[model samples]
Target: MEGTIFSIIPALLMLVLVLLTRKVLISLGAGIIVGALFIHDFNLFGMVKEIWFIFYEIFVSEGSLNIGNILLLSFLLLLGIMTAFLQASGGSRAFGDWMIQRVKTRKGAQLMSAVLGLIIFIDDYFNSLAVGQIARPLTDRHRVSRAKLAYFIDSTSAPVTVISPISSWGAYIIGILGGLFAANGITDIAPLEAFIKMIPFNLYALGAVLLVFVVAYFKMDIGPMRTHEQRAIKTGQLYDPNQDNIPGDLGDTFKPHENGRVFHLLTPIGVLIIATVLMMVITGINNTEGTVNILTIFANTDVNLSLFTGGLIAVLTNLLFHLQQSKPKANTMKIIIEGIKTMLPAIYILLLAWMIGSIIGTLETGEYLAGVVESASISPSLLPFLFFIIAGIMALATGTSWGTFGIMLPIAAEVTSISNMDLLLPTLAAVLAGSVFGDHCTPISDTTILSSTGAGANHIDHVLTQLPYAIIVAVAASVGYLLIGTLNQVVLPLIITFAVIIGICLLLQFLVKTKLSDE
Candidate 1:
C-alpha cells in the first residue's frame, strides 16, 4: 500500500494543483517535481541528481529517440511549424474567408468545421490547431463561442487519430500491438498485421467519432455545453466574463489579406500529407525481413527530415506563387519566421512533456502499477472491461495518453498470456481507449489544454463542459467492449452498440424537453 501510494503521489499532486489553481502548466510542473521528490525521498541532493540523470537519459541516451517518444515529439514540432506557416502566409485566414463565403448559417459553419477536423486525421496536435485556427473566424462570425469550437476540435483530435491507419498515432498503435504479440509468445505475426486486426476492436475511438457527428448534425445540446451553444447563437457572447469590449477580436482579426490565395494555403499541407505517407510506405518496405520484421524503421528514420522537407516545400510553393504576385521576397521570410514563432509555446510545452515522461519512465511507475493490477487477480472474462477502466484511470491521473499506453501496453500483453487470451486486439483496444479517456478529461493533458487554447475557451471551462459528454461516451464504450468480448464478433455488434448508446442519450434529451414543457 505504501509503495503504491508513493508511486501515485505525482498524479495526486497534479490533480490537487489543477483543482486548486486551474493553472495547467504549474500543475504539470508540480507533478514532475513530486515524481522526482518521490524518487529521492526528500533528500534534496538526491532529488537534484535524479533530475539531472533523468534529463540526460531522455535527451542523450540511445533509447531517447525511441519510436514512441520520437514520433510524438516529431509530430508536435511538425504541427507547430505547419500551423505557424499556414497562419503567416495568410492561407488559413484565406480558407476561413472562403468557407464563410459558402456557409451563411451558424449550423452550416459548425458542420463544415467539424467535417474539416475529421478529414485531417494525421495527428491530434495538427488536428486541434489546424481546425481551431481555420474555423475560429467562421465559427465566431456565426456566433459560435470558442468553447464550442474547441469542443468540436477536441472531440475530433484523438477520436480521429486512433481510428486512422496512416497517422503518427497509427505508428504508436502498431508499436503497442507488437509488444502485446511478443509478450503472448506469438512471434509469427507482423506488427502491421496485428494493428490491422485490432482496428475493428477500437470501440471507444469509433464511438467518439459517431458521437461528434450526432452532436453536430442534430445540434444536440447537453449540460453546460448546451447552454453555451445557445448563448453563443443568441448573443455572440462566450461564457467567459473576461471577453468584454475587445475590438477586432479572434473573429474580426482573421479577415484575410487581399493577396491571399488557395495555393498559398493548400500547397504546403498537400505536400505534408503526401510526404508523410510516402515516407511511411518507404520505411515499412525497407524494414521488412523474411519472417522477421524490423519495426525500428518507424522510429529510427529521420522524421525531422521528412517534416522539414514537406514544410520547406510548402513554404517555397507559397512564396513562388503568392509572395511573388504581391509582396517582396524579404516579406515572405518574415511571414515564415512569424509562423514558426506562433508555434513556439506549443513546442516548449511539448519538450517539457517529453522530459517529464522520461522522468516517469525512470521511476518505473508502470512496472509498479502493473504489479498492483496483476496482484488483484482480475477474472479473464472481465479483463477487457477492467483493462479499459484501469487504463482510463491511469491516463486521467497522469494527464498523458502516451505515458498511459507505454505503461499499460506491455503489462496488458503479459496479462493476456497469463490468462491464455488472444492478446493482440483486445490489449490494443484497451490501451487506445484508456489513453483517449485520460486525454479527454485530464486538465493537465496537452491535447485538452491545446483544445482550450485553440478555442479561446478557459481551460477549466472546456474541461468542465466536456467531462459529462466524455463520460456518456465512455460508459457507452464500456458496454460496447463487453459485447465485443462476449459476442466475439469484431465490427457489427460494436457498431450497433455505439448507435444504441447515442440513440438512448438523444432520446433522454427529448424526454427532458417534454417534461420541461409540461412543467
Candidate 2:
C-alpha cells in the first residue's frame, strides 16, 4: 500500500534502464536491487538479505509452483521437447520440404507461419517456439526476412491465444475475473460468461491477427520492416548485418534424413493437437458437478494439466514413430531428454519473469496504478477507451501481460459495478486486448524473446520491426473501444475497427513500396 510515487519508481527504473542498455536481465536486476534498498530504508545489508529472500522464494520455495508460472514453464518445456523431437527426427526438415512445394511465394511463407501460429492456440509459448521452428526453414527457402518471420509468430502467438476460448490466456483471465467478482460480490455477471461476451470486443487481438493477414496477403511492409524485407530479398540475406548477429549456419541448420517423410513430422503434431483436445474434454467431464454444456466444460477444465499431459503424449507418440520410421532408428530416450534440454534458456527466462512479477506484486505497483485509474474522473462513456490505454501502458511498462491482467481486471470489475454495469464486457475486453497489445510491443516480454529465439531473428530487430504494425493495431483497437464506449454496439464497432485497420494498412502499403517488387 505504498504511495503511487514510490510504487512506480522501480518500474520506471526498469523501463529506462532496459531501453538505454538493451540488457534486460542486468536492467531488471538493478531495479529489483534498488526496490529492495528502498523497502529496507536504504540499509544496504538488509536490502541484500531481502533480495536474497525473494530469490529463494521464487527459485527454491513453493513460489515456483504458482499456477501461472507452472503453465508457462510447462509450455516452454513441452515446446522444447516437441521442437527437439521434430528437428532430431528430421520432421522439421521434412515439413519444411513439404511447405516449400506449396508455399512458393514469400507471402505464402509468412501466411503459413501465421496459420500455424493460429492453429497452435493452446498456449502462446508453445505456438511461438513450434511455429518458429517449423516456419524458419520454409520462410528462409522463400527468402522471407527472419524479422518478418518473428513478427508472424510473435503477433499471432499472444493475440490469438488471448482471443481463444480454450487457451491458457482464456483460463487465466477467467480465473482473474472469478476472483474479482467473488471479492466484489458482483452476483449479476458470471466470470466465464463475461469473458466469452468480451471476446468479440477484444479489438486489439482481432486487429493484430487480421493485420497479419492483410500485411502478408497484400505484401505490405512498414517502417523498419520494409527496409528489412527489401534488403533480405535484394541481398538474399535473412538478417541485417548491423543489427543482426545470428550465426551464418542458422539458416542452413536443418537437415532431414535421406528418406524422411512429411508424415514423420505431421503425425506427432497431429497427435499433440488431438491429444490436447481429448485431455481437456476428459478433464472437464471428470471435474463436472452436474450436466454442463461444452462451454462450461471448457471453462471448468484445467488448462495446465491438459496441456502438459497432451504434450507428454505427443512426445511419446513421436518417439514411437521415430523408432518405427527412421532407417537406423535414433535414440529415442536421448533425443527426448535433449529436446527438453533445448528449452533451458527459455525456462530460466520464464523463471526470471515470474520472479519479477512476484516482486512487483510485493511492491504493490499494480494497486497503486489501479488507485490512479480510480482517482481519475473518467466518464462512463470514456471508461473503455481509457481502460484500454491504461492497461496497455501498464503491460508495456511491466512487460508482463498476466500481471497486467491481475492488476486491471479488479479495477475494471470495480469500475463497471460502481458506474455503468453495461460497460462490463467492453471494459474487460479492453483490458485483455490492451495487455496483449503491449506485451507484443515490449522487448522484455518473455514471448517476444522466445519469438526471436524461435525465428532466429535478432531481438532488437524483431522489436523494432514489429512495433509499427503493433501501433497500427493498437490505434485501431483504441478507436474500437472509443466506439464501444459511446455507441456500445459490439458488431458494428468491430466492423468499423477493421475498416480503419484496412485503410491504414492500405495507406502504408502505398507509402512504403517494396524495393524488390520492381525486380
Candidate 3:
C-alpha cells in the first residue's frame, strides 16, 4: 500500500466516517487501525504492534522524550485552566458586558474577531487560541455561533501568518525558498524579496482574508454555515445542543461575581502574548549562530517551549486574579483540576490525530499523491492551477499543511525549474495557498481542532460548517491562479479575484433569505 493509490484509502475512510457519524475519535481510530493493517500486510498481531509503536513514537522518538509534543499538550491543558480561571473570576462576563456596550451588533463582533486574527500573526497556534479567548466573549454576547467563530479563527490564522514576513510560518517558508533558490542557481532575488513578491500571487491567502471581512460585513452565510448562523440568531443557541464531548465547554462549574473586573481577563491574556513573544526571541537568539536577525531568530525559535512557558505564566497570573476575589476562598486546586478536565476531550482528539497522521506518513500517502502530480505532463500555463489543486488535495488527505508544504513545494519547484523558471514563485505561492485552504477544511488538522477548542465548538460542526466557505475562497483563488498562469503577472489577477469573491458574497446575501421571527 505504501506509495500507491491504496495508501489513500484510510484517509478517505476517515473523512467519510467523520461526515457520516460526526465522531472524531472513532473515525480517527478506525483510520489508524486500517492504515496500520495495510502497513503490516493485514496481519492482526502486526497491525496491533504497528498501532502501539505509533502511539509510543509520539511520546518517545528515537529513544528521546518528545519535548515538543509534551509541551504542546501541556500548553493546551494550561489554556483550559486559564479559561476556567477567567470564568470563575467573572472576567469573561465582565469583558463581554463592557464590549456589549460598544459592539451592539453581530457584524461588529464577527469583524472584530477577524481583525484580531489578522493582528496576531506571529504563529497560527497562538493566533487561533488567544484570539478565541479574547473574542469569544463579545461574539457570544452578540449571539454569534461557536461554529462561525471557529470559522473566523481558522480562516484568518494560517492565511495571515503564512504571508507575514516576521511570523513563524513566513520564516520557515523563506528558509525553504532560500534553499530552493540556492539549489537551482537562481540568484536574481533574495529569499525575503521572493517571499514578499509571492504574497500577492498567493491568491488563496489573500482571498480568504478578504472573504472573512466580507462575510462578516454582509452576513454572507451560505450552506451549512447559514443554518448555524440562523440558529444562533433565532434562539441564541450558539451550537448544536445535541453534540457531546465538545472541547472548551466547561459547563456551570463555577459562578461568576457581578462586580468582576474586565482586567481579570485582559491582564492574564496580555501576559501570555508578551511572554510568548519574548520567549520566542530569546530562544531564537540562543539557537542562532553569527549575527542575529529577526528571520534567523524565528527560523530557530522553539515555538512549543515558548508556548508552554507563556501558558504557564498566564495560568499563574490568572490564579492570582482568582485569589483576589472576596474573603471566601474557593478550593483553587479543585477548580484547576476541573479546568484540566474540560480539556481532556481536546487532548484525546489531538493525540488520536497525531497517531493517524503518523500512520498516513508511514503509508507514504502524500508521496503517492505528489508522484501523481509530478507525472502529469501538463502545459506550463496549467502548472500553477494543477499544483494548487494537488497541494490542496494532498493537505486535505494528510491533514498537515506543513507536511504538504514539505512534499509539494519541492515537487512544484522542481517541475517549474525544469520547464518554466518564470513560474517558480507563482507555483510556490499557489502551493502555500492551497495547503492553507485544505487545512481549513479538514477535521484532523491541528489548527482546525484548536480553533474549535478555542471557540468552545463541536469539532465536526466546525469542520462541516467551514467547508463551503473555504471552498468558495479556494474556487475564487483557483480562478486567480489560472489567470496568473495565463498572464504571468500578479496585479490584475488578484484584483479580479477580490472582485469575484465580493460578487459571490453579495449575490449569496441577496438570494439566501433567513426566516427569522421577530422577538
Candidate 4:
C-alpha cells in the first residue's frame, strides 16, 4: 500500500505544479522525475539508468514505433506542412479576407469562426491552430477578445475532433473500442462497427459540439468569459496588443495574390481531406482480414506513413496550384520548414507525455487504482457514473487525455467485463469523454496551452477564464452520462440529457449576465 501511494506521488506533484504555477513542460518533467525516483527507490544510479532506458525505449526502440503516437505526430507534421503552404500561397488569408468583406458584425465574425471550426473536423491540433490563425485577425477586426478567441479555439478542438469520424481521434476511438469488444466477449463485431455503435453514447463529445453551436448562435457568455468579452468590447483591443507578433510577421511573409481566388485556398484543403480519408480506407482494408479485428490493424498498419502520404498530396497540390503564377519555390520550402518548426514544441511535449505514460504503465498504476476501486464495492448500478467522474478527475489531474485514456481504458474494460454490465460502450465513452473533459479544463493540458498560444492569450489567463465554462459543460456531461447508463434506453435518454444540458447552460447564462450587469 505504501508502494502504491509512493507510485502516485509523481502524478500528485504534477497537479500541484499545474495549479500553482501553470507551467506544463516543467510540471510534466517534474512528474517524470518523481515517477522515476519512486520506481528506482531514490537510488541515484538506478534513476539515471531508468531515464536513459525510458528515453531510448520511447524514442529509439520498438516503443517509439507505437501506432498512436506515430499517427499523431504524422498528422501534426502534415498539418504543419499544409498550413504553411496554404499561408504561403495566401489561401487561408484569401479566404479570411473574403470573409472579412462579407461579415459586418462581431456576432457574424464569431459565427463564421465557429462554422469554420465545425467544418475542419480533421484533428484537434489542426483545428485549434488553423482556426485561431485564420480567424484571429477577423475576430480582432470585429472587436472580439483574445480570451474569447481562445475560448472558441479551445472549445472547437476536442469537441470537433471527437465527433468527426474522419479525424485521427476517430481512429483512436476505434482502436480502443475494438479492444473493449474483444475483452467483453463480443468477438464478432468489427472495430469500426463497435466504434459506430458507441457514437450515440458519446454524450460529452457530441453534447460539447452542440453546446458550442448553441452558445455561439445565441451569443451567450458566462462567468469569466463574460468579463473578458465585455472588456474586449469596452477597450476595443480584442487582439492581444502585447502578443509575441511572430506569427503575424510569418503571415505577412506569405501574402496571397491580389486576385484572391477561393479555389487556391479550397483546393489544398480539399486534397488534404480526401487524401486522409483514402489513406484511412486503405489502412483499414490492408489490415482487415476475414476476422475484422480493429486492434490488428492498429498494431500492424503504419499510421505515420498514411499521414505523410496525405501531407505530401497536400503539399503537391499547393505547389502545383500556386506555380501558375510566380513560382513560390523558396516560399514553399520556407513554409514547410516553418510549419515543422512550429510543431517541435508540441512534439517534444508529446514525447515527454508518452514517456510518463510508459513509466506509469510499468508501475501498473491502473491496476492499482482498479484494485482500490473494486475493493470499495461501490454499487454496481453506480459504476458507470463513478467511472465517468473518476476518469475525468484523473485526466484533469494528469493533464493529458491520451495518458488518461491509456491509463483508464484497460481498467474500465476490465471492470465492465467483471461486473457483467452491458455498459461497455458507455464505459468507453466515459473514458474518452472524461479524458477530453479533463483535457479541456486542465491548466497544464497541451491542448489548452496550444489554444492559448494560438490565440495569443497568456496561458494562465486562458485557463483562468476558461475553467468555469469547462466545469459547466462537464457537469452537464456527467448528468447526461448518468442518464444513459441508468435509463438503458438510447433515444429518450439522449433527448432528456440534451434538454437538461441546454437548460443548465441557459440558466448559467442568465446568472452570468446578471452578475456582469451588477459589476
Candidate 5:
C-alpha cells in the first residue's frame, strides 16, 4: 500500500471532504486515520498505535523535544499575542486611518499588499505572516475581504521567494542544482547562473505575480472571490457570518487607546523584521562549515529559530507599548491570554495538517506519484508541461512545496539530462512553479494556513476563494509550457502567456460589469 495507487486515497478523500464539508480539522483527522489504517494493514489496534506514534513524533522525536516544531509553534502563538497588542494599543486602528487617508480606494490597498508581498522575499512564512499584519488594517479599512488579503499573501509569498536568488527557497534549490550538475558532469553553467536563467522559464510564478496585480488593479473578482468581495463592499462584512473559528480574529478581547500612533504599529513590525533577518544571518554563520556566502547562509539558516526569536522580541516590544497605554481596563496577563487563545484554532489546524502530511509521507504518496512519472513514456517535448502537472499533483497531495522540490528536482534533472539537455532549465523551473501553485491551492498547506491566519480569514474561505485564481494562473502557465515545449522559443511563449493572463482578466472584468449592469 505504501507506493501503490491506494496510497493516494487518503489525500483524495481528505480533499474531497474539505471541499464538501469545509471542516479543515475533521477532514485532516479523517485523512490521518485512513492513512494510518493503510499503514497498519487495516488492523484497528495497529492503526491506533500508528496514530499515537505520529502524534508523539510531532512533539517528541528521538527521545527529545522537536525543537524546530516547538519553535515554530511558539512563533505562531507570539504573533497572535503581538496582533492583540497591536490592536489594543490602537496601532492597527491608527495605521488603518492613516492609510485610508492616503490610499483612497480598495485597489490601492490591494496593490499595496501585493507589492509588500513582493518586497519581503526572504522567506515565505515570514512574508505570509508579516505582510498580512501590516496590510490587513489598510485592506480592512477599504472593505477588502479577508479572503482577498489571504489570496494576495498566498499568491506572492512562494512565487516571489522561489524566483529570488537570495531567498531561502532559492538557496535550497540552488544547492540541489549544484548536486545535480556535479552528478551529471555538467560544468558549463554554475548553479547560481542556472537558477537565474531558469527564472524566466518559471512561467507559473511570473503568471501568479502578474495575476495578483492585474486582479487587484483591474478588480477582476471572479468566482467565489467575487461573492466574498461583494459581501465585504455591500455589507462591510469581511467574512461570512456563518463561518466560525477564524484563526486570527481578536474579537472584543481588548479596547484600544484613542491616541494610538502609526509608529506604534510600525515599531514592533520593524523589530520583528530586523530581528528575524539578523538571527537568520547569525544562525547561518554559525551553521556554515566554511566559505560563508549568501546562498549557503540562507540554505543553512535555522528559519524556525529565527522566526521564534523575532516574534518574541516583537511581542515584548508590543507589550512595552501596551503598558504605555493609559487604558484602565487593560490587564497585561489577561490580554496576553486572550491573544494566545485566539491563535489556538490556527494551531489546531496546523497540527492536524502536519499529522496528515506525516501520514502521507509514511504511505509514500509522493514516491508513488514520482514513480508513475518516472515510468511514463513521455516525449522530451512534453517534459516541461508534464513535469509541471506532476509536480502540482505531488505538492497538492503532500501539502508541501519544499518536499516536492526535494523529490521532483532530482528526477527532473536526471530525466532531462538523459532525454533533452536543452529543456533542463525549463523542466526545473516548471517544477518550482507548479509546486508553488499547488501550495497555494491546498487547504492543508502550511503557507496557506498561515496566509489565512495572517489575514484573520476563515481557513476554508481562503482555500475556496483563492482556488479559482490559482487555477487561472496554472492554466495560463500550462499553455506557456506547452508552447515552449513544442516550439522551443522563450520570448514568444512568454509573451503569449502574458497575453492569455491579460485577456482572461479583461474578459472577467467585462463579465463582472455586464452582470452588475443586469443587477
Candidate 6:
C-alpha cells in the first residue's frame, strides 16, 4: 500500500514488452511478477510465492467469488459455443451464400459487413469472429482488401459494443461502477441509469462506427488503407506487400448443406437477441417491483445473467437443429466441444485482463492518476474533457479497455459528485469513448488481434491500414468531447457532437481524395 510513482513501472514494462514481443499474456504475467518483486523489495523466491498467491486469490478468495465476473465468463463461453455451432452447422455458410448473391460490388460487401457488425452486439469477440467468418468470403468475392475487412471488424467490435447496452463491454462497465457506487455510498442513481445516459454522449464510439460506414460507403480509403484497397482492386492482392504471415487457418469454405436454409442461421440468432431482451425486461421489472422507469429497468437489468441465458438457449437450438444437416454429420457432443474451443483465446485474454486489472488495483494506479490530475488544479468543465484524453492514453498504453476502465472510471466518476450533476453523463461517456478509441486501434488489443485472425489479414497490416482512420476519428471525437463538455448549455451536446464528427470525417475524406489524385 506504500507504492509511489514507481508502481507505474510494472504497467509500463507490460506495455513495452507486449509491443515488442506481441505476447500479451506473457507480458502481463511478467508485469505481475515484476510488480510483486518490486513490492517485496527484489526477492526472487518471494516474488514467485507472491505470484502463486495472486493466482490463488483470484481463484479462491471470498471476495473474488464474484457472480458478475463468473457470469461474464459464462456469457463469453456461451457466445463461442453459439458461433461455433453456426459454423459447424453450415448456417454461416448458407447465410454467406445468401448475402453474396446480392452483394456484387466491393462497396456493397463492405457496407453489408458494417450492418452485420451492428447486429452482432452481444460481445466484441463474437462480433469480430462472426463478422469475419461470415463476411470474408463475400468481401473476397468482391475483391475487397482483407485489411479493410479487418478494419471493419475491429472498428465495430469494441467501439460498437462499448456504446451498446446489450453487450459484454456494457456489462463490465456497469459492474465496475456498481462497486464504486457501493464504496462511496451514492444511492441517488444506479450505475446502469448513468450508463444509459452516457450512451448518446459517447462520441468516439459513434464517430468510429459512423466513420467505418463513411469510409465503406464512399470507398475513400486513406493512407495505407488506400494502398491496400487499390492493390486489392488492381492486382487482386488482399494482404500488404511486406506483411504475409498469417498464423492461423482462416479457413471457412462456403459449402452450404442440401438441407440447410437461411432459417438455420437466422432462427438461432433471433432467439438469442430476443431472449436477451426479454430476460433483461423480466429480470429488471422483477427487481424494481414492476413499477419503475425505463432508466431503472435498464439499471436493474442483469446483463451477464441475461447474456448467459440467451447464449445458452441459442447454442442449444443450434446444436439440436442445424448441426444434423452439415457435412460429416458430427454428433452434438463434438459440435459443442468445437464451438467451445473457438472461444478459448478470448476467454484466456479476458481472464488475464482481470488479473492485470487486479495487479494495477493493488498498486493503486488510479489513485496515483487522480492525485496527478488534482495537483494540476484544472477548472471543473475542463477536467472532464481532459479526462477523456487521459482515459484514451491509459487504454492505448495498456492495450486493454477493461484495464483502462478499471483504472480510470471510478476516479473519473467520483469527480461528478463534487461537480454539476449534468457533468456525470459526459464524464461517463468520456471513459467509454476513450477506452473504445484505444481498443479500436491498438495493435496489441485482444479484439484487434482477433479481428486480424478472423479476416485472414496480416496483423501488422491490419493495424497500419486502420491506424490513420482511427486517428482521424479519435481527433474528431476529442473535439466533439471538448464541445460537449464546454458548450452543452447553448445547444444539445449529443447533436453537436455528431455534427462535428460528420464534418470532420467529410473534410478528411476530401483531403484523402486530393492526396490520391495528386499521387
Best first by lDDT, ranked: 5, 3, 2, 6, 4, 1
* Native-to-model Cα distance after best TM-score fit, residue 436 in candidate 5, in Å: 0.8
Root-mean-square deviation of candidate 2? 3.9
By TM-score, who's the top model here? 5
Candidate 3 whole-model C-alpha lDDT, 0 to 1: 0.91
Let me know the TM-score candidate 6 reaches against the reference structure.
0.75
TM-score of each: 0.79, 0.84, 0.98, 0.79, 0.98, 0.75
Superposition TM-score, candidate 3 onto the true structure: 0.98
User: Which residue pairs collide, candidate 1?
Assistant: none
Q: Write down the RMSD of all candidates, one decimal each.
A: 4.8, 3.9, 1.8, 4.5, 1.0, 5.0
TM-score of 1: 0.79
Candidate 3, 1-519: lDDT as tens digits: 899999999999999999999999999999999999999999999999999998998899999999999999999999999998888888999999999999999999999999999999999999989999999999999999999999999999999999998999999999898888888888999999999999999999999999899889988888888888989999998999898877887767778766578999999999999999999999999999998999999999999999999999999998887677774234688779988988899999999999999999999999999999889888999999989999999889999999998999889989999999889999999999999988988888999999999999999999999998898888898899999999999899999999988888877765564333221
Better of 2 and 3 by lDDT: 3
- Segments in model 6 whose C-alpha atoms lie over 4 Å from true places: 1-3, 56-59, 63-85, 117-137, 140-150, 157-201, 220-259, 282-294, 326-341, 397-428, 441-466, 481-519
Task: Give the better candidate number (1 or 6) by lDDT.
Answer: 6
Clashes found in each candidate (C-alpha, N, C closer than 3 A)? 0, 0, 0, 0, 0, 0
Writing each residue's lDDT as its tens digit, candidate 4 over 1-519 gives: 223755566777876786687565687788888778778778888877887888777545663455555656666666666656666666666776777789988888888777877877666665665567567757876778777777878888887776555666777767676766677676767867766776777666777777767767787777667767877888985544553332222434465555546677777766766776567557866877765444444434444566566667887887787667575634556777877776665566566766676666666565566566656766555666777777777666556777677668777777777774677667777777777877877665767766765665656557777777677667777777777677765677567667876888888778867876999
Better of 2 and 4 by TM-score: 2
lDDT per residue as tens, model 1, 28-55? 7777777778777778888788777665
**Per-residue C-alpha lDDT of model 6 across residues 1-519, encoded as one tens digit per residue:** 324687678878877776677565677778778777876788999877877766666556775576766776676667656665666566766776887788877789999899999888766766776677667757876789998999999988888888776655776788787888787667888888867877777877877888889889988577788888889899887776564345222234223346666778888878877787778777767777656865456557776677677778887888777535645445567656655565566556556655665666677665576577656766667755787887876666556788778767777767776666567668877887888777765555768877876786776677778888778777777777777767754246556656766776678788877876999
TM-score of 5: 0.98
TM-score of 2: 0.84
By the TM-score metric, which is better: model 3 or model 5?
5
